[model samples]
Target: MGSTTIGCDQRIAWLLTSARLLNPDPELARRDGFIKALADQGIKIDNSRISRWESGLHPVSGQVAATYEQALGLTEGSLVAVAAGLRRTFGNGPAPREGALRGADLTDGDMDRLLELIDEGKGTGAHWLRLVGQLGTYDRVYLRQQEWAALSARLVQELAVSVGVGFVRRYEAAAGLIRHPNAQRHLTRAIGGFVMNPDTQVVAPVLSLLTEIADEAAGDLVLRMLTSEDKNLRSAASSVAAVKVSRGHFGAHALPQLESHVVGSLRRGESLDGRLDSFDLAVQLPDESWERAMGGLRNRRAFDLVIGSRRGGELVPTQQTAAVVQRLSAAVQRDTPTHSPHENDAMLRRLLRESLLHAHKPRRHHAALLLAATPYAPAVAKHCQDLATHSNDLMAARALTVLMRVGHRMGRSRVLLQSLAETRPTIRARALVNLGLNPEPIKPAEADALLGHLDEHSRPVERHATMFALGMNGGTTLKKLAKSDTEWMARSATWWLDQGPALHDSDAALDQIGAQT
Candidate 1:
């Protein structure tokens, strides 16, 4: 092969690397499998060729390169990325002009031109499939600093409302940008703009991206955005609400992901020192569904092992709660104790009792649930109240969460709401979340009282909940909430309005209506 063939080997190397990144163990090719398979094909390539491909040795043959490309599902010109990588690595590089997205300032005119250029016969599926392919291409070139601003801005304007699936494509493109160190900062800012745009109808796609990339800070950013009072923004953030509901479901199917995600975060090394502030990304289960996750039949043995065994609290042993929860819950229910059941019972009770005594300390779900299920209410309520006031925001959120769950059962929501009304803004924010999740119906008048909070508070969560409650309750309040600033609530309100008149004549429905005047 001539020196012109250099890019081939690098391309092969990149393909191999990218595949391994996605699936470290490509089961189809174990030790010597590639060589043996090639031998069977009468190709008789040296092991070095395979090793070179893995380690990025010499340029591969056109035939072999095509085979690798097929196996990897690489798009056209993907090998060019190897050249891009080489330029990035060795400093010998292609001219910036060769691969840069030309005509960077794409206006409506440019977009229209492209639209007209495409054959209209491209069906929806083909369009999306092509878009996905194009996205991978975009990532290879568009992530760099000078290149991204123009490309991203054009993309945001062009694809923002084209289709929901396109938004997903956009996000995948963004993820590609994120992986490239040279382009990440610019792409990050661009993504923020794309997501925050009020005119963008592709909120779900953006949200899916946000969640995929969520870390402590990113999760907090998402939580803040999801509660925004802006109707358009909130509506766009519905993906987040759906995610929240899913994470919190604790359903049989979701348990494993939750354990691996949520419980694992808590027991991670950082958390052992009590330094972890948020488990947003770490946990897949919602805060509300933890009890079901832990207490469910499938989780019993794992639950027993964690709470019963000395090794339970340790980080590594219970890394993925899903499998453990399922296995343990199954085992415990089968009456096959991993340890002595009586001893486990005693230990749990003792832990519950101890939690009550030091109720002021930040408590985990197990400790809180044990207290809630305890025969004692006053003690539980007192600690719950303390948690509601705790300086740590997440702790306060969790505290209010436990209180709301057990409070209504004890007929204490009125008291809880009364107390919440006087709490700090941070605590009040969580309180509103609890109130919105309240199972009991409030009267229209009472619901109005909560709805009235929309005008008084600036917090997004509070406003959203107040709107949700108002929508749930009917009459003039519902109409007003439909026009509310928060898009999420407005959508909900609109939905309720469409459904409410049909059910209006039912006495059961009227009784179920928010407290009447």
Candidate 2:
């Protein structure tokens, strides 16, 4: 409708102008005559005033915006919603007042609208897969009592035969959130079959969901799998029981290489945190009962315990360093003579430094994980500071997290902003989270990128990432986003605006959330 692509602030204004220009009845749609037509619809506004709005000089009231949509034969509130999204994104025009969306609670009408959307999308398997992420982010999803039984049954029917790892992950996330008894019954029946499925990928994720809705009878079913010879099934079951497996089926080949890399670095006395973060490197150490291979490593117990816990997924710096120091203190008290009380501490630092700049990504991931957990050393501090601007975005992002842990944020603000532009979604999402958690004011460029990145039509993973990024960045007008056509995004925005922002989004926490696949 316009000669050129409309920029950020021009969305609503462009929409209005195009509506008039493309109108079938030119006699009543142009500025002067449109005013008369609008006035007859009880929308009292002068022709010049309309021009000011269409020219992007000012904004109309929510009522007028809604009325304009209706008068232009557009859906009611369509313009108003776009205008709100535009203002929220660009800080353009004035903020909506009476028309602005408020609160997180869904009204009956909102719930009905949601059911309608679900009904429309239900034909496609993608719809059910999407709901896994969509419904997961909401503070709460309400279905009127009458809608629950049928909906849950339909969900169970879909879950029963769903294939593919992507579908499994979405279903796992969704199933974890569904605890209602009625849903649980159907889900249990469906999930039991998946757990016994031959494919490791199928059994692995389903096993996680099984424990969520698994009942006493299901326990007998799981019990037999516990003794099963299938390594993958045993590993998944072991995970459920909060026990360790000697060699887990998942990431089996990766672990020894990770542990071996770190051990080699330990022998050489160095490792860098940057190396650990790039490759999603996480390795579980043996419990004290089995004992760590390296007797001189004082941080072994801490290392084993951190990874041993049922919820422990990755190592965070603060916890690791604290545990290392505590072990060192205990060793000194016991007059232990294996080496300096801090020999293990020094060994850990050396391990990190040696691996920091390693060419291999897998080795780097291990070293970075270890580096974050262990105490900081001046030698590696410079490497992290330097790595914040490294060509490797992974290293750079990890450097940001490690530096922030040590109170080194002031010098890295520019690097922090650059991180927001990283091409990798994983690193970019991590940086956006870092940006949101940090207290820095949002700059116009950073703000624009954040806004532009948020599209309702974007993939659920990326869309939610941007939502948290923008909302957590602070001082955002979320009313429009809170009512987004994308239900999941809308629920996320509404939750953020109402309550989610105040919750802590620490680097470790964000890492966990952002790492969701």
* Best-fitting candidate, scored by TM-score: 2
Per-residue alpha-carbon lDDT of candidate 1 for residues 147-227, written as tens digits (9 for 90 to 100): 457554544333332222222233334444454545555555665776665433234434444433434444455555645
Candidate 1 lDDT (Cα, 0 to 1): 0.40
Cα-based TM-score, every candidate: 0.30, 0.31
Model 1: per-residue Cα lDDT at residue 228: 62
TM-score of 2: 0.31
Segments of candidate 2 deviating more than 4 angstroms: 1-348, 351-382, 392-408, 441-445, 454-462, 486-488, 502-517
Q: State the displacement of the C-alpha of residue 45, model 1, in Å, after optimal TM-score superposition.
A: 69
Error of 1 at 479 (Å): 3.8
Prediction 1 TM-score vs. true: 0.30
Cα error of candidate 1 at position 175, Å = 29
Tens-place lDDT per residue, model 2, 1-517, is 1012334344456556545654556654556778888778656777677777677555545445556655676533234434433343335345544332121334445444545655643322323323433454466666565555555544443343232222332353345445544345555655665456443122543554554443555555554665676544654554443212222322333334334433433343222232232112223334431234344334554335334431333333335345443443344223322222233334343334323333323233333333322223232444455555666554565665544333233543644565555665545654554455455556656666666765645444355446655565445546666676867656656755643232221122111111111
Measured on C-alpha atoms, candidate 2 has an lDDT of: 0.44
